[model samples]
Target: MIISILVLEGPYNHEASDSAYNFIQAALAKGHAIRGIFFYDDGVYNVTRLMDPPQDDRHISRRWSELGATGIDMVVCIAAAKRRGITNEVLAPNIRISGLGQLASMIHESDRIVTFGD
Candidate 1:
């Protein structure tokens, strides 16, 4: 099954984000393809490279980076990101530093869009 996940909360002081991360791993392990992981609200901060968590804890940013490295498509809504000071780097001919359009498109194209709420 193809899955597109929408994460709407940040990682601090919550288990929801970590739960979503584990769920993604399980989905991948079950041979389900991740169509996209879209971040909205505080969740957009998950992608910020500037994140520096405690040394002993699971770094959510690094976890996400690893997920991205696995070839899963990751997206963050522009408005939400801007509000949280998260910046999406766009270094291409078509892609730009922008909004929820790509995520909405991914949702529209996917068979499912699961949401994680805080």
Candidate 2:
């Protein structure tokens, strides 16, 4: 099965991004395909590659990075990200900065749009 996810909550507060993260990891472990991960609302924090949490906590940033290394496309809502300050690196292509057009595009091109929101 092909699974795509939309995270509307953020990793800073609770593990709202956890569902998507765990889901994606499990899907890959089971040999399923991950279409992509779309971040919305506070979820845009997931794309801020500059995050640095204390050593006592889970390195949320690295976990997401690992997903990227594994080739699962991760996208953040452009408008939402701009408001919260998440952006794309000039060098990262797949992690491009995008908007609802891209979100709609993902929706149009995917099998599911599972959202994790408050």
Candidate 3:
């Protein structure tokens, strides 16, 4: 099935982001296609390229990038990202800065839309 994912929380501070990541990975492993991942609210932090967590911790941004490398679009809500100080200049490779319209389009095009976080 073709799927789209929405993430609404920042990494580490909550489990939502990690859960979303795990779910996406599992879906991909099962040979499902991901239409994209939309980062909304605090989830925009997942696309920030400058993130540097302790070595012991999973690098959340990198994890997203790896998924992006496989051709899944990683979209960050421009308004939400700007409110949190994430600019296009610092976006990770394969991450795109876009408006909510992109999210809407993804939802319209995907076979299923799954959201993680409150």
Candidate 4:
């Protein structure tokens, strides 16, 4: 299966980001192909390089970056990102800032679209 993910919530404050990450990992373990991950709304925060957490805590942004390094398209919505003061300079590795057109393309190319949010 070719699946794309849409995340609408931020990290730490909510469980949506963690849930999405776990879902992707499980899907990959099951041999499902992940077409992409589109971060919209507060979800854009998940790819910020400025994120810092306690040493013992999981680093959410780093996790996303590592996942993205596996060749999955990890995109942050440009409009949403700008609204939240996120720019290319602050984006984590393997992640890019793009427009809604990218999300449209992901939706069009994906066989399934799984969304995690309120």
Candidate 5:
């Protein structure tokens, strides 16, 4: 299956991001293809390269960047990101800032769209 993910929440403060990551990992392990991951609202923070957590804590941004490095399309909504003060200079590697049209295209091309958030 070709799956696209929509995340609306941020990391650490909520479980939505973790859940979404686990789901994607599981899907990939099962030989499923991820068409894209669109980060909206607070979810846009997940791809910030400036994120620095405690040494004992999992680096959420790094995790997303590594996943993105696997060739899966990772996008942060440009409008949402800008509203939250996120810019291209702060984006993690392999992640891109794009408009909502990318999300629409993901939905159109994907066989399934799984959303994680309120």
Candidate 6:
């Protein structure tokens, strides 16, 4: 199955981000293909490379980068990113900034669209 994920919350503020991450990982492990991950609202924070969590904590942004390394497209809504002060200079290497049109395209192309949080 081809899956696309939309995340609506920030990384540490809620479990939604972690849940989405685990879901993607498990889905990939099961040989499912991920169409993409589109970040909106507070979820745009996931693409920021400036996140420096506690040493023992999981670096969510890094995990996203790693996932992108495996060829899964990762996108952050441009409006959302700008509203949250996430700029291209601070964006993760594999994360791209785009408009809602890209999200629409992902939804149209995927077999399933899974949304996390509000």
Can you give the TM-score per candidate against the true fold?
A: 0.86, 0.84, 0.96, 0.98, 0.98, 0.97
In order, the Cα lDDT scores of the candidates are 0.76, 0.74, 0.92, 0.97, 0.96, 0.93
lDDT of 6 at 38: 97
| Order of the predicted models by TM-score, top scorer first | 4, 5, 6, 3, 1, 2
lDDT of 4 by residue, 1-118 (tens): 9999999999999999999999999999999999999999999999999988999999999999999999999999999999999999999999999999998999999999999997
Q: Tell me how candidate 2 scores on lDDT.
A: 0.74
Error of 5 at 109 (Å): 1.0
Question: Over the stretch 1-118, how does candidate 2's per-residue lDDT look in tens digits?
Answer: 6777888888868667887788777777998777778878888776666777898987776787677777877777788877876656521334656677767777777777777777
Model 3, 42-88: lDDT tens digits are: 99988788989999989999999988998889999999998999998
Model 1 misplacement above 4 A: 89-97
lDDT of 5 at 41: 93
Model 2 off-target regions past 4 Å? 89-94
Best by lDDT: 4
**Compared with the true structure, what per-residue lDDT tens digits does model 6 show for residues 22-117?**
999899899999999999999998878999999999999999999988888999999999998998999988889999999999999999999998
Instruction: For model 4, state the Cα shift of residue 53 in Å.
Output: 0.4
Candidate 1 lDDT over 88-116, as tens digits, reads 55211121345688887887888888898
Poorly placed runs, candidate 3 (over 4 Å): none
On TM-score, the stronger of 5 and 6 is: 5
Q: What's the lDDT for candidate 4?
A: 0.97
* Model 3 global lDDT (CA atoms, 0 to 1): 0.92
Q: Which ranges in model 5 have alpha carbons more than 4 Å from their true place?
A: none
Clashing pairs in 1: none
- Shift of residue 10 alpha carbon in model 5, Å: 0.6
